[model samples]
Target: MNYDTVRSVDPAVADALEAEVDRQGDTLAMIASENHVSEAVLEAQSSVLTNKYAEGYPGSRYYGGCEHADTVEQLAIDRAKELWGAEYVNVQPHSGSQANMAVYTAMLEPGDKILSLDLTHGGHLSHGHPKNFAGQVYEVENYEVDEESGRIDFDEVRAHAEEFDPDMIVSGFSAYPREVQWEEFQAIADDVDAYHLSDIAHITGLVAAGVHESPVGVADFVTGSTHKTIRAGRGGIVMADEEYGDAIDSAIIPGTQGGPLMHNIAGKAVGFQEALQPHFEEYAEQTLKNAQALADHLQDHGFSLVSGGTDNHLVLVDLRDSHPNVTGKEAEEALEDVGIVLNANTVPGETRSPFVASGIRAGTPALTTRGFDEDACETVGHCIAEVIDNPDDEDVKAEVAEIVTGLCEEFPLYDDDTEGLVFE
Candidate 1:
């Protein structure tokens, strides 16, 4: 686990790497889909396991001398099963999108209808976006969130399911702030005889820590990312009921990716172990609290929040009514100038394009992981509101930047005091 390489072969690349770390240390990352992984996870990700080429599963590899690789991969599998209470786990897909692709390939035929949430309405690209492979292969029918409530209308979803009669029903979101009703989706799937697949990539950490509802028992297949709120390396996992274990594993191995990244699997094992600890529950709870606090603060400051608030770690601010002059692009740029990082996102009935959305999505997972709490979240929210309210005001942006820097200092991401903490 040699994590001490400071210089790159190219001086320009080395400078960029160092600069990126400084940027991360100084900026307030409000991106809902990002988080700071622990040192233990980082060590595993940069470990010697990168040298291995173990193409197959444990004890059944096509290559030789994979004793340690087998141990690491199996550990990830076992821990994921334990964490999610799934009958089987496949920690091989390169990303959450790939995991979902494998699941689709394993069960559905080309041109088979699939019901998923619309991408602009809080769904992911892998969930049948026209440009994604899922849409190219399957006939995708999309359900949308209610415009008034900004929440999923189960009745609407059920109506779509009944009409579409999809082979699979995909449930998950990348920007949705409310809780997903898994049982409702499951019942709808049952009625349509569709397989229920829950992509919990964004909320796996909360589900693992028991802060959010688990979709494992209800969904036939569950796909998640190792990063995001899980605070692991960049990788994907697919967990399924016992009946689909063989098919899902085969789909991931032969149908989608060729070889697995053993190093990331090792990191996933460490992340799962951390998630199993009781303190991880505290972390998940704090993440939710910080999100709610930020949402309330923004609302109090006269910013209209989509869905009115958040039940999870992210919030979507509808700038259409709050700051009609400020586009999502302008707000994001203004926040970036002040060292606050968040992505521009589309609202439920967005009139603007995806690239230039009508809303900004913000979250507290990364900052909370860095030790920022409810009070800090409120301050951060105020900073964001100030920037959006006065995007052209350089003085206001400077003030917010100073405040964000002060908050970062208070909540150091990597403390020097615990430099060598290892996982047993």
Candidate 2:
């Protein structure tokens, strides 16, 4: 991928852009929240639509020359509805957090109470972490996973909701490995008379492919990122029954965001179309298989996994048990040095600072996109175990790096002849 056009205009930015593509091509991206969008999706995002500002939804735009914007946005909304079987879909909000913000803005007033999963127990910052807007505006309480089982206990969540009497209840999570029981959360919300907002940000693609349970018809509202498992580029979407459609639209447009990212919506359209193909389901199923394979391989090497394993695309390894002296940060750095990239995450019963948490979260989405199967994931898992087991061993790192280079070559990201944005 050559960046000749960019180099002609700005050589420095061009070099950085080219270097990034090289880095992605060379490393294994195991971050649970990341995936590689198709080249088609990338091109759509880099389109001229970025120049246009469509201030309103589809037909009722507040700006002129929105014909193309309307077409792309409508296609994105329609495709999202088809993918998730939602009665209404909004493909706007800049990110999953903003999508959650729109829902909160539409349904609750300031000081309204929100009940959600605890952050360290697999929740997101937008659900009401102290540093985020939701936390500042709403009175929030959190429920946690059972430390013994490393899974959410619905009874505990119900009890927390009853005690908190929150106006809204959030379901779905970030670091959790088990399948979320959408019905259980919906029931809890019903019992408490609270609005249920299920944020399926990390598993949007899995849900679309029917590999994971969907929250669309079960919850009062559903929000997801267009990237992550979906590979739709960087954006967010909100879905609901038609009853709340107008409120959601208004909240997103006048309340949270202004003009929609029309280019990103185009990417969403293309990616959603790609997902609709039959191969996407095969991809989703393989993603789960690969995660399980990695989990088993890690366990074989004596790593303790949260929930004992994974039912989804990610597995969270608690370093405290297997390697008491190793922090998740140290494991992350060591693995990155050998080209296996993931993240340090806080575990269910975390005792250390979030930055130096005792667990690592790894996933199979991007690797699966790069054509990795169960066997390939196990190979990567073995490499991860080796690096973490002997983080200070230079010979081990060299061996792992060589294996990573071989794997990267075996599963090339882009064609050799593909020009534009190529790094040296």
Candidate 3:
């Protein structure tokens, strides 16, 4: 996986690039919002189309020489429409966060009110957190999940919405492990006369494959990351009925961004085409099964999962109950040292700082991409528990590293010439 051309151009940059490929090939990527794209997608993302400045939609571009760009972007839009069955889709936003931004700009005024899930309880920062532009511009209120169940409490949400009478109710979560009720959220939005934006960023592929409930036609607006569970290029998409189509497209173009990355659009097109295959459904199912196996095994080791169990591709382990002294940061660092990579996350009733959260979040999307099954995921769970239980023990780390090595060997990655972007 040597970057020969990059090495000839810049040795230092090439070294870093090659090292990243090695890192991914060797490590267990358990980050729920991350996944591995095919070599075909990688090639498309690195194509010469990067040099082209396509400033608008197909056949309506603000620039010249957009023939290829039109082809790629339209292909992406068509494939996405087919995959999600959306009446309209815009594959422009650079990220999921940006997709949320586009929806907000299109639907609400500056002082409009928004009701969203609390950040510590599985919501995204863009939902209403003070740190984001959405929070800065709009008056925001938050709803809570059922503390006892670690799931959304619709009764509370309805009550909160009734009082707040928000202009929008944002659904979708970053670290939630249970299946959400999209229709119930839509009902709440209806009663309150608010727009519904379902940010299915983490479960894009699952929803597309029918493993998770579809928010496409249920919500007023649906947004997702093209990279996460979708395994597409690095970008965001907004889907809605034909009524919101023009507004979203305008908001994305002159409102938010200027030029689109045609290369990434090409990648999105290629990956979406790949996802339409029958095997992708099998992949989505295995992703859920592997997550369930991991959650069960971790619970068996006395680790407390946020909701007692998971119905999706991730598990939220609140370390407070199992390891009273270990923070999620400590657990994450320990696991990473043993070649297992995930993230520290906040739990429902979080007391610790967000930087050093009360919980660790792990998912199966990347490992499932690497061909890992339930038994292998259970082994991963055992290794994770052992390491978190003994972070400073050299023997434990060495043993876990050996196990990770064997797993990587069995499910090898990029066994082709796609190393450092040389795809063939």
Candidate 4:
């Protein structure tokens, strides 16, 4: 983990890398989209395979010296297939967004219509946000969560799908805390004759472990981030029936990306192997339990959670009723200062801009990876509520910082070796 050679050659780069390691070690990462990969996965991601330019799929690369590349890539593909039960898997998209792009480019033409959830209501930008390439290339419409329930309004979605008659309907989310009804989404897509691309980017691990429902056999295409809840290093993946395999492979290769991130694929292989262990199921279950603890404790503290609760690993706290004056950014900053790091997120019916949203999103994947149990998570929830409620209070922050420090020490991330390197 020490960047010794880099430090000898470029101390400046080494210093920043060391600082990042320190940052992750010292602070709690509560971002719903983030997780801590195993040391083996980290080592794989930093492997020498990064030097290779296997500009095509395994055993069929445009370049020579793809033997090792073929071995690692096939392992990733096979492991992914075993994990998700997809007839075909593409481990070359580089990111979840790119995975979505591969599906879109492969299945639909330019100016094709897309129906997706609103970004403020938990949908991802890659689904159809105006700032993203999907929005620029596709005619997009959005469905929303029920204003009162904070769950997807299936009737409303069906109505919009019928009206828009989209070519595809994106069925995954970014900050949503509920277990999505992929079958229901497939029904709507089927009714409207639209393809369903279920982007289980956040719940990749949960879905893989069967803690969450599988979309692989239900949706027309399933896409996800290899990181996040999966802890498979950082990359993207696409899964589909064998029918669309060739198109997706083509889309990924000459379409959305050049060569795959082979090193990250190796990491994915290692992480997927780790996930295949019986313990990963326990870890996935614990992740959800910890999230429920956070949600329950926050609600107990008088905070309002969108959806009222959670079925997955994140809780979206809408501050509108509990602390109308406090913005999500303020809450995020306050929590970060106290060493509890999460993110500002848009709640349903948000009146504020995305930058200063009305809600905060926190998740348990990283904490659970650090071995946080429900009790520890409940304590984290208390610290978060205290800080969010009393952002300007040094006394509150100091008090919360102690709790965070204690938790970090009790569930230390990384080892005592190179990770003990100083930040500043």
Candidate 5:
């Protein structure tokens, strides 16, 4: 974790970098979209491969001196294929949003219609928020989860699809707490004669480990970020059958991005290799178990949970019912003050501004990576309930902070003597 070379060259930036590492080591990361990658992944990302400008796929590049780039990129591609069982894979998109952009470029026109979940109802901005490029270029329609059940109503989605007649139907989600039935979305897309793009950005590792149902063979296109649950490099990937390989590759390179970040791809290769090991599945399963435990503890404590529980790594708490006066932002600040890091998020039927939403979303992937188990996650849930229940209590915040510090000490993340970050 030491940055001696960086310190020698630029002491100020080095200080910030070192401080960031220490911050991660000290706090509890409960953000559903964030994870702690292994030190091996860290080293690979900072390698000299960053100097290259590989503009195309492996063994078929648009530039010279790309042999090592080809090797690293191919290894990433191969491991991703093995992980997801896709016939084609593209590891070059800069982020999950860019991956979606490439999918749109490959399969859609500027004025095409896109039907996706509503952003406030657990969908992502890239799915077609009014301010995002996808919404500006595409005619977008949105579907909401059932109000009472907090789950998708397939009948309503079908009716919406019939009326909207979208050119593409996008599935998967960001703040969603339950497992997705990809085949149902595929059936709706089939009924509408539309293409299906399943964005599994948040559950890439769970899907790869077979803990969650995958959309790889079932959807028209599958895209994900490597940094989320997969904990690879900070980038996106697109997967499809070989029939759409050339179009996807060209769309990602010329239509969306310029050159590939070869160093990041090297990191992806190393992380993918790590994920292929047997213990990664144990980590993935533990992630789900931890989420369940957290969800149960929160619900038992009288908090309102979206979906009533979780089938994955996160639980979205709608504070409107349990704590009427407390906004998500207030709870977020109080929790951060106690060294527990999570995010305020929008829930279904949101009435407040997105910035001060009525809900909080928390996940267990990062804590699970730090070797947290079900009991630890339940304790974290208790800490959350405590702070949210008493957002203005300085005494409670101090007590919770002490407990968080003890947990961080108990489950240390990166050890200098160990071989990178390891999970038993």
Candidate 6:
């Protein structure tokens, strides 16, 4: 919170930091995989614990001077276990991708077949993208969504699993806007004798807050990012049944990574504590409500939303019909010009490349965190619709930008007593 210190060291860098904060204060952030962390979480992330090098699990470190570091690490692990009802947790993977990698290292051999959702549909890169380690090291097979429903086709998943006889099935996604069918995934994995790993990186908070059904109860392994919806610092966690605890811990510590980020683990502990609060349920419910409201507003204004609408915090907008002349990249740029932030995304069966996607992905997590409700969601939806409908209209963009500033004024984030606490 002390800008004076940073300014004395490097004035230019300080100016840039202030400018970015000003921009965030004026705009609407709708990226589904991003959220606003609480002051406590940020404090823990920037704490002195970052100076330590804890090489092993709590109370069993390979190095000395880790007594307090061990306590922080154990706190993170204990909180994660309570949050997800898992028997064991490894709070050391640097990211969700690394968490998945650790699982593969623990369980699978090279060239083992793995079944996962197709990347072009809703799956993430770690879920077996050809260029990723999972694909390079394992034989990968994919299942697609139902073209009509825009949801996973369980029958297709089962058929592929049976034929492929995969050693593992990775279930979870990045952009699909509906609830995961964990029961179907479990049944398919059972039929194929495959280990089930659910990467709930995007929905970890929803699961913790009881807004979404948790896959932890049924999955052999569950991986997640503590940030996304969980509102933690930037880190990843892996939770498993007791049967896989030793393998997972060894994989994380020796197979993939070295010393853990103790400060980030402290932040994760704070976030898990926040998730346990009674009001977190309300926050998660409102997050979904805001998304549904925004989706409906967009649809009413003639935008085509993937999966009809969202049951969670994100909505994938297919712009092919709404703005045939505008690519997702162009739409994103236009919206950015008007103080709204979102990401370009690929729609299923799209002819366009990922960089110039045919669709835009928007969400309500950050906005809802800042206290935006259904009414504000509707207004924001109209603003996006206007910008996308007229990407080249500078006057319209300016008007929408003014409206966005006004909305931010109404639901200010970190503007009161907590203004400087984010850096504390």
Cα lDDT for residue 254, candidate 4: 96
In candidate 5, list every pair of residues with a backbone clash.
none
- In candidate 3, which residue pairs clash? none
lDDT of 3 by residue, 1-424 (tens): 5689999999999999989988999999999999999888988999999999999899999889999899899999999999999999999899999999999999999999999999999999999899999999999999988888998989999999999999999999998999999999999999989999999999999999999999999999999999988899999999999999999999998999989888898989999998999899999999999999999999999999988999999999999888989999999999999899999999998999999998999999999998899999999999999999998999999999999999988887876543422112
Evaluated with TM-score, which candidate comes out highest? 5
Ranking by lDDT: 5, 2, 3, 4, 6, 1
Q: What lDDT is obtained when candidate 6 is compared to the true structure?
A: 0.89
Give lDDT tens digits, candidate 1, residues 1-424: 1223555356776677667767887888899999988888988998999998988789998899999999988989898888889888999888999999989989999999889999899999999988998898899989999988999999999988888889999999998999998999999999999999999999999998888999998888899999898887789999888889888878877778777899999989988888888778898999999999999999999998889999999999999987988899989999999999999999999999999999999988898888888999999989999999899999998898899889878876555655522322
Off by over 4 Å in 3: 417-424
Tens-place lDDT per residue, model 2, 262-334, is: 8999999999988888888998999999999999999999999999999999999999989999999999999
Candidate 5 has an lDDT of 0.94
Model 5: lowest-lDDT 10 consecutive positions: 415-424
The TM-score, computed over Cα atoms with residue i paired to residue i, of candidate 2 is 0.98
- What are the lDDT figures for the candidates, one per model? 0.89, 0.93, 0.93, 0.92, 0.94, 0.89
TM-score of each: 0.97, 0.98, 0.98, 0.98, 0.99, 0.97
lDDT of 6 by residue, 248-360 (tens): 98898889999999999999998888888877788899999999999999999999988899989999999998788899999999999988999999988888999999999
Clashes of 2: 7
In candidate 2, which residue ranges exceed 4 Å CA deviation?
418-424
20: Cα error in model 4, Å: 1.2
Q: Is candidate 1 or candidate 5 better by lDDT?
A: 5
lDDT of 4 by residue, 1-424 (tens): 5689999999999999989887898899999999988878888999999999999988899999999999999999999999999999999888999999999999999999999999999999999999999999999999999989999989999999999999999999998889999999999999999999999999999999999999999999999999999998698999999999999999988997887889989999999999888889999999999999999999999999999999999999999999999999999999999898899999999999999999999999999988899999999998998898899999989999998988888887776743521111
